[model samples]
Target: MTSKIAVLGAGSWGSVLASVLDENGHDVRLWSYNKEQVDLFNSTHTNPHYIKDHTFSKTLVAYNDLAEAIDGAEYILFVVPTQVTRSVAKQVAEILEKNNQKVDLIHASKGIEEGTYMRLSEVLAEEIKPANRNSISVISGPSHAEDAIRKDITLVTVASRNLGDAERVQHLFMNSYFRVYTSDDVIGVEIGAALKNIIAIGAGALNGLGYKDNAKAALMTRGLAEISRLGTSFGANPLTFIGLSGVGDIIVTGTSTNSRNWRAGNELGQGKSLDEVIDNMGMVIEGIATTKAAYELSKKRGVDMPITSAIYHVLYDNADIKETINQLMTREGRSELS
Candidate 1:
């Protein structure tokens, strides 16, 4: 079955998804804010700035205009940065209202809003009118664009309050190399997806500091504990923290050089300033912003996310990384399960 899908955002993941959908025989319009990128994609079938050397399906089209990209689309997927999600949703709402159209909302972006701490789906719900949307869903897991583009065996979970909607998306993306699973733990999946980036940054920092596997292993384990603690506080299923979006995501993002968040933390650990790292990466390092939001959320929810707080201090307070590590190592001991 052929469907019209609009994928918003032109970053690495977004472009890869657009290409995947195109290969799935859907009419896909990829929207990018940059006109130059749109033109380049349309002309060359490649996103040189992000996914260099990877060719997209020729059937995939790129649009600079948001409304045009979404026109008559049945599925609207948001892959933009979390901070810009609300603004883009606002524009999408206006366009949908004007066109008297309704579409299912899906987001692949991962982060909590810095001030509101709302998840991406929550931000979409607040902006897009209920009348203008059918169902809201999220896609998340350990899959990375750099791997997926090579037709790597990638698996992800598509979750929605509505199981049928999740199944629908599962069919849309599943292929020989891409496998999709359905889950109903929206809160757990989304929380795991957003918070894992923070842990990944810590993992990269460990690598940058020449920490051994023992330290990396400890960081990842404790980081999952922090993720689960915070996630369960928000009514997420504890079991979901062990699923693909949770432990799997942390392992991949936290350890991989392909991860922008990990790379950013690596640079920071090597003594680069946050500004320097950001300017050099030329991509949104989600963990940096996510650390701030999660830090605030932990305080509001009174969750003991020591690692998140440590990363927050290093990134925001100019605290010495070594001192922060010492503080974490010296903290009073408690039950591991606590």
Candidate 2:
């Protein structure tokens, strides 16, 4: 079933989704904040900003205006960074609401906002009035932009408050190589999506420290343990963290050098400060904020997230990496699966 899909943000992930939908015979409109990037999509049929080698389909259209992008959109996918989801949603809501239009929404972003600590859904609920909240969903999992663009077999989950809507979203993007699953666990989905980056940074740091797979595996596993401890406090299903969005995402992001979070962590592990690493990456690494948020969350929930706490100290408190590792190792011994 062909549908009208609008993808906001022309970054790697957004462009990949646009290309995927276009290849699936849907009417895809890709919205970009950068006018020159939009022009590149319009003229050369390539998104040089993200995927330079892959040719975008003719069915894909680029628009600089939000109105043009969401015009009659059946599914509006916001692919912006977590920090900007609210602002972008506000703009989207104003534009669509003014036009007397309503569309199903799916967010591909992952990260809780700083001060508000609002999950993407909370941000949507805030930007969109009560009337439009039900239309929003979050699609996330192990798929990376680079792999998705190459037509690899990528699997992800679309979580919605409404199970039917989740199913609708799942069906909307299921193609030969792209498989979509439906989940009603929005918190589990979003938390897993957001928290994995923190662990990825830890993994990257491990790599930078020339640590072994045993260390990476331990960090990755414990990372999710803490993620769930906090997620459960926020009403997420404890088991959902074991699913694709949780453990699945953690494994992929934590290990992949292509991951911005991991790359940033690698630099951090190599002795660069947070400012220096982020400056070099030249992009928003969600893990840094997530690490901070996780620190707060762990305190609030009384969950002993030693790993997350160590990460917080290393990043913001100037704790040495070797010292952090020693602290983690020296913590009171406990069963692995308690």
**Native-to-model Cα distance after best TM-score fit, residue 113 in candidate 2, in Å:** 1.1
Q: Count the backbone clashes (under 3 Å) in each candidate.
A: 1, 0
Q: What's the lDDT for candidate 1?
A: 0.94
Task: Candidate 2: list runs displaced more than 4 Å.
Answer: 132-134
Residues 69-155 of candidate 1 have per-residue lDDT tens digits of: 999999999999999999999999999999999999999999999999999999999999999999999999998999999999999
lDDT of 1 at 213: 92
Among these predictions, the greatest lDDT belongs to 1
Tell me the tens digit of each residue's lDDT in model 2 across 89-134. 9988888778777778889999988877789988887888755444
Candidate 2 matches the true fold with a TM-score of 0.96
TM-score of each: 0.99, 0.96
Alpha-carbon error at 215 in model 2, in Å?
0.7
lDDT values for all models: 0.94, 0.88
